[model samples]
Target: MTTNESIGDKFISHRMLSSFDINDELLQKLNTKGFTLKSEIQAVSDDTLRLMCNLSDEQLNTINELIRKSHKTIINHLTVSHIRKLSGNRIHTSLPSLDIALGGGLEVSKVTQICGEGGVGKTQICMQLCITVQIPEQFGGLSSHALYIDTENNLRPERLQSMAAFCLESYPELKQRYCAESMVSNVHLFSCNTNSRDLFELIMSRIEHFLDHHQEVRLVIIDSIANLFRYDYKGNEFQREYEISQMGHKIKSIAHRKRVAFLISNQVTYIPVEGKDTPALGKLWQTYCSTSFLIKRYGEYRKTYTLKSVNIETDRHFFFQITKNGIKEVLPDEVVDAIINNNKL
Candidate 1:
């Protein structure tokens, strides 16, 4: 609902100013001098701010200290205590090898971006998480619901149905605990067009209410966040870039506040000469990504996935494949060929 372009941009605010010991007159004076913008105040020298607003040296020093605290509060409210408490409560993705690689699964209060070209099983992985999150926690689930923003309009219920059927057969007790229909229905899908701004608004508005009222929600999936901005503002590069960064901030804020895991699929970009590839939005988008996983085709039926993150202890790279029952570990050609031959069995 807060549509102003500069709404979340200011790390400094009137609230921060009023919280200080400064009088109303000086605050009014600071306001008159157009010191409302955090960047403007942060850019100008403290001496300059003092000169322009006519402040005492002691008052200026206090204001600067308060400003730093305010920025830290607004930018990152995560305290050491909160991190310690939530450390063990991770969202296990339900894939054994990936669970080991991720040290569990996708983590709450952080963003995990899955990067890969088209048809590389990115969406399949997201859908799997959506379904898996419904299982009870003791059985590797978050026992939660999910919000899926389908940017590409590619979320297929048939695929989900098939996957859910597999889960029901494999873990019939999980099915008994919670009905299959309930799990499928819990994954609320929102179709977002190419307008990143609208998509952002949709997400921000629903994030709090969804998590608060629907206590089952523990995951948020934005399948291909890069596409919305790419299509809408192709010529207006500046606006496009701004929206992307702002969107990232909003998503991170919601994830941390709600303590929900974010699975964002991103389009892959690469350098031909170096044979290096990364997500499309550049480092600006990377600032919020707690973990990044890149997917590349290995041979024919297999795909390679590499995990990278400064926060995590180790990097994991492995081969997997898109199969009838969602993503699974790749098997050797001989093993696969033998399995395919009914006579050999």
Candidate 2:
């Protein structure tokens, strides 16, 4: 006849657990009432079910229902899983919608390369993402910091300042909350003019410091992986093949280990395939990268177009203009259709 509340109160109020001590009688009563011994103390205790104990079948069902309801409430309130070992989950980017395109809105500890030819807004995109990632979750971001490893001539304070100013104009509150105190504080940049061993060592040191200091680093961008490749090897085809592959493997491993998104830019060159010419980043580079994007200037349009060549089921091409702003995704269907219709000549 004991109500759930009454039972909880009885259990909570019972000092018998301490006074009576462990005995056959106590164990019998507990077992009869539905208290079972948990086998693995570490495994089940650490799970989403914060507390689960042996109880009568009815009581167990009630507790399970309560836990389910609690989970539903949390989900309804829009709280989701936090990134593992990440301080927070708001990632800022130059383009807000770009984050949306990336499932979980970026900052989930995966390598996301943004490759393009020279002056195609690769570094700019990375910088913008850094700025956006530092903004709080309430403002629609991962609410995490960024670390930028600039291997080229792309680290410009004034440029970042200008980008921040632009973001401020769009979202005044975000500017007030994050940018007013310089959210860029959360962003650490390594702009060393070194290559290969020196570059790797510098990055390794900085990465350690960032991981130690910041609980979460949403993004790490290595601008132009080509720099290290060109500098390390003397353009010997055989040497280049092995070296680039090794570089890619190491980069991929680093990204996986750190669990931060990596966006590495690469150089492109024209190679003869069969009887025709194709633009690519050599054989090793292509083989090593999980995703490959080909970017080239669209004639004299002063804009660069990007081709997402990896992971396509059909022979469909995607094009996006590279502006002073950043890499924007152009819908494949609309652009391709327009190109075909207009270029009937």
Candidate 3:
């Protein structure tokens, strides 16, 4: 039997059931019972296996032991050196203060979420990272490609072109190795205008395949994962949370195994109890990300506060602004000077 290996050391499809010592007849029965993925088999109850697949007690125990062993093979056992090597490998946001607040920058092999209300530059930051990730490694970038899954259709190629041009101008040396056209082309965009289930399927089924072909892609941006589920699961909060959890787990797994950074943008919802807005999708959704930031807009400037993080201080914030060039840090001195001048007027 032919087996398909997925990210990490796990078998993805039911074709790998043979690895568990299952005969062809039983494998066919499992497939006919709608257990097509290795995960599905692991999730099934022993009673279900007996009643549905006609597996004896002995067979069940053997399959369970094999599944446990299969799982153990993929469990990462990191050494001090491995941890140290991973610590330094991060994708910079190009804004020094923001990078500092982020403990270097958007961390690779982790899921980082940015939540904000409308016009707070969530998508802008995402677009900026898409370009920044492509910057050459010599310039302190990952020198990698980006995959943008646009849920709100907010990604504008013209804006990316302008940002890429500005990046080239900032690093004139980059002009020799990269052009604005090439930089823009490296950012692959996919529009998912459907509901949350479609988005989930895209991540579960197609994303790995796409990443397999585009090995250079080290960053995946999902601009506004909140939009799709906000209204779709109305009055069905449990289902909404369940779907979000599944997607988050898959994304986190992919990020870890592929050594890619996932920058997810989310919307804010008004919490009447707190008398303020907080990241949408509830507290359950927040646990999935390794780090999360909340961006707030104030006129032309924006402040991003760390809601949850591993390396950075909680509630730590830095100011920034969106210009024709892209995201630029609003230094403390600049903010103070502007306040002083406004007071005098």
TM-score of 2: 0.58
lDDT of candidate 2 over 1-345, digit per residue (tens): 334333232222211221223445444544332232221111123332223334455544444454445434433433112212232253544443344333335544344555556775667667777776666676655667678787886877766766666667768777546563385566787775576666656554556566667667767777876777665767676666645544554554455455566666776554546652233346545433333444444432222232322122212334454445444555545555556656521
Model 3 clash number: 0
Candidate 3 per-residue C-alpha lDDT over 1-345 given as tens digits, one digit per residue, 9 for 90 to 100: 111122222212212354565667766776555443454555546896778777778777776776667656533442334333546468889778667755688888777899999778999999999899988777767999999999998999999999999999999988988998888999998899988888879987889899999999999999888898899998998788767766765786677668899999999999889897799988767756767889887667787888876455688888888999999997867766666656421
For candidate 2, what is the total of clashing residue pairs?
A: 19
Best-fitting candidate, measured by TM-score?
3
lDDT of 1 at 97: 58
The residue pairs that clash in candidate 3, if any, are none
Using lDDT, give the best candidate's number.
Answer: 3
Candidate lDDT scores, in order, read 0.69, 0.51, 0.77
Cα deviation at 156, candidate 1, in Å, is: 0.8
- Residues 41-63, model 1: lDDT tens digits: 55457887899779889878777
Winner of 1 and 3 under TM-score? 3
Q: RMSD for all candidates, in order, please.
A: 9.8, 15.9, 8.4
